[model samples]
Target: MRFTFKCYATKHPEQTVIFTLLLSIFLLAYQLRIYEVPYFRMIGLKDFEQFESAVWLVVITMGTVGFGDIVPVTIFGRMITMVASLWGAFIFTLVLISFGSRFNLSTKQKQAMHQLVSQHKAARLIISAYRLYKLKRSKEGMGSNKSVLSESDKGISSLMRRLKEMAKDFKDERPKRRRVKNSKSQLI
Candidate 1:
């Protein structure tokens, strides 16, 4: 899918920005911890040497990988992990819902689909109706069997009769309308 700023802004302006901001905040907090928290640990950080290493840990945690390379060592760090996990879940759900809404068909598109399906159904109904008509005519031609149609044949005849009535009802004959003119009000 191609990315457009307009689409992003129109779809969900606040959600996208807020989610990113929160994730950045988490990354920053973990990186800038003044002292060692027992539960949170960055494996390769000898003395908070690199910010990127902390970012890497945050990303993996947010992604729910939890590779065991870096872990939360203290109670405070554990609380951070819990918050991150909850945030990740919320963000994931939001992303899924957004994806569904974005890819869904527009009203006009859905209506067009409905029309196409209706047309196809009508075509099939017409074909069946025509087949029934042909069967009736062929039976009429068989004079010897005219008086003794099978149960199935009788059912088909009944169906054809109903279809004929339906066709008559659907016929495009409009009732005449009487137009009333306001003769009292003349445009002078």
Candidate 2:
């Protein structure tokens, strides 16, 4: 039944979690048995008993907390412990690699997103400043006595051109806008 379940687990990932949990429980039970069982009474640790001890040892080693209370005495048991140690090291290295890769990717993405937002904010500030400057220049041109229209026209034209160029640059780098539609067919 255990072999059948293990085979099924390999093929079905959804079942694998449940199977692994059950298998872990079984291994823990077997580890208790091995710790209690008299060594002189047995010629060899049978298949089930050996498997249970090996799995439990691997779990303990992987967790990096070896309880020295359950040391292997036999040559076969020692060999199993050695293999479990190697497997535990490999599994831990893979976990660290995965975490590092994800952390680097997230940091890079965050930096890029911040740069894009800063660029947009700078463009907005430039446009607002240009608008205020134009308004001030128009008020001065209106009050002056000599050919105020021509001076006002030149100032307004230059301000408009600069604002247009800034708008273009901002549009090029702006994040794509998502349009939300209301039930009344209006876009928000």
Candidate 3:
């Protein structure tokens, strides 16, 4: 049964919500039944109907609204109400935590996306600066008029070399995976 439920939940998230709602309703109904049973009523409350009303009242209380219309008159009835209240509170808390976690995850994802965009803009700015510097030097006849442009060329070459080295380092750090064989074969 547990495995079947897990499979259903994995395959369909909507089904999980339906299941949870149904389970809550079933539990509420079962509690009502326990209250109505003759043996349980004999030891618990004045009457089963009163117990039923009390259970619903407790549900409302757990929802943070106290009507004060129905009250538990017996120790056993009060004990049942306390148990129901605690379970209801716990289920409600679980729901809040689930929503909170999703909100936190989405916020973190947005922050990461913003950081990536900013980094890309910074890289573009640096490349643009390098291009502008090159264009200015070329227009000034610094290289074509027999004047030494070695310093500027050296700077550009060094920058390109550093970029290449960084790329190589990144490639080296990547995980290696086996490639699948293709259907085509070549004759040597």
Candidate 4:
């Protein structure tokens, strides 16, 4: 019966919503009956005179919290209690899966995100290399006539050039955007 309910719910989500609401009402009514009847035999209730106490018991049972305060003595009551606990677990699992899927990234989106991160890192390297190059050039002084490049300065220059090339490659692969004009801009 639980398997059938799950299959039907998966096939028809709109109907599942309605069925879930109706089932909740039915369970609440059944629990109320369990509390009102003397033959059902549930422990932990000081008094069965109030409807609120029955609702609380139903909630506690549905949550699978058998606080040992309330227990079903009859076989029928025990079956009902088990059904409520399993049903609650099933509902909770479904809700979590739906939410997880909603937030999950697709393969294409993940790839694009990876490309964006790589591009950002490349751009940062380019900027850092250019800054180092400028600092080296400034330290040599404007009055110096020497045109010779040290090994370290030559390496920094090569790194700066390579980073620029990588940045250009990344830019070429990025998607192009179209411009849209607002009403005010169109009027202008």
**Regions of candidate 3 where Cα sits further than 4 Å from its true position:** 7-18, 33-55, 101-112, 116-188
Which parts of model 1 are misplaced by more than 4 Å? 1-22, 25-57, 63-70, 141-188
Clashes of 2: 0
Please write out the lDDT profile of model 4 over residues 15-34, one tens digit for every residue: 67556745673666466556
Candidate 4, poorest ten consecutive residues by summed lDDT? 175-184
Clashes of each: 8, 0, 0, 0
Tens digit of lDDT per residue, candidate 3, span 2-107?
Answer: 9998887666645465466457645664564465455545776554454455456656755646576665544655665666667667666755654455454343
Q: Please, what is the TM-score per model?
A: 0.53, 0.35, 0.41, 0.48
lDDT of each: 0.58, 0.56, 0.55, 0.61
Q: Is candidate 1 or candidate 2 better by lDDT?
A: 1
- Per-prediction RMSD in angstroms? 10.7, 12.1, 11.1, 9.9
Candidate 2 local lDDT, 42-142, one digit each (tens) = 74545335555545655775456777656666565565566556655655564555445545534345556656665776768587667858776666757
Evaluated at residue 145, the lDDT of candidate 2 is 53
lDDT of 1 by residue, 61-157 (tens): 6667778776656566667666666767666666677666767765556555555655555565687688787877777766676455674488687
> What shift in Å separates residue 141 of candidate 3 from its native position after superposition?
33
Candidates by TM-score, descending order:
1, 4, 3, 2
- What does the lDDT read for residue 178 in candidate 3? 11
* Predicted structure 2: lDDT: 0.56
Of the pair 2 and 4, which is ahead by lDDT?
Answer: 4
